[model samples]
Target: MSPESLRGWVKRDRIDRGEGGPGELTSAEREELTRLRRQNAEQRKTIEILKKAAAFFARDSDR
Candidate 1:
């Protein structure tokens, strides 16, 4: 699965556990997780845009 999907799963698991994952995260670890989540979101958005662009080019080339 995609990193984004894994991130979503982890987030849900953390929520269900009342905080953190299998092992509780320290403040520093939590900050890092937050940063990583933000980066993951940006990467997912970029991938989506790239996919659309690729599709558009492919369709155009078929003309």
Candidate 2:
């Protein structure tokens, strides 16, 4: 592997093993963060859709 890529992998491994430094995220934390971010985005999209549907129905009722 390239030296830079190897270095990055080693760094991540160290972080995952809790040997890198303080305040560094472990693999589990990173995965959870990714999952939460995806879920948040999905929830935001659903909220937007619901809001638009509510507005459309309200407008239709006035017609």
Per-candidate clashes come to 0, 0
What are the lDDT scores of the predictions, listed in order? 0.85, 0.95
**lDDT tens digits by residue: candidate 1, 1-63:** 999999988876766567865676655667899999999999999999999999999999999
> What's model 1's TM-score?
0.63
lDDT of 1: 0.85
Q: Best candidate per lDDT, number? A: 2
Could you tell me how far off, in angstroms, the CA of residue 2 lies in candidate 1 after the best superposition? 44
Q: Lowest-lDDT window of 10 residues in candidate 2?
A: 15-24
Query: 1-63, model 2: which lDDT tens digit per residue?
Result: 899999999999999888978888999998999999999999999999999999999999998
Question: Which lDDT value does model 1 have at 40?
Answer: 100
Residue pairs clashing, model 2 = none
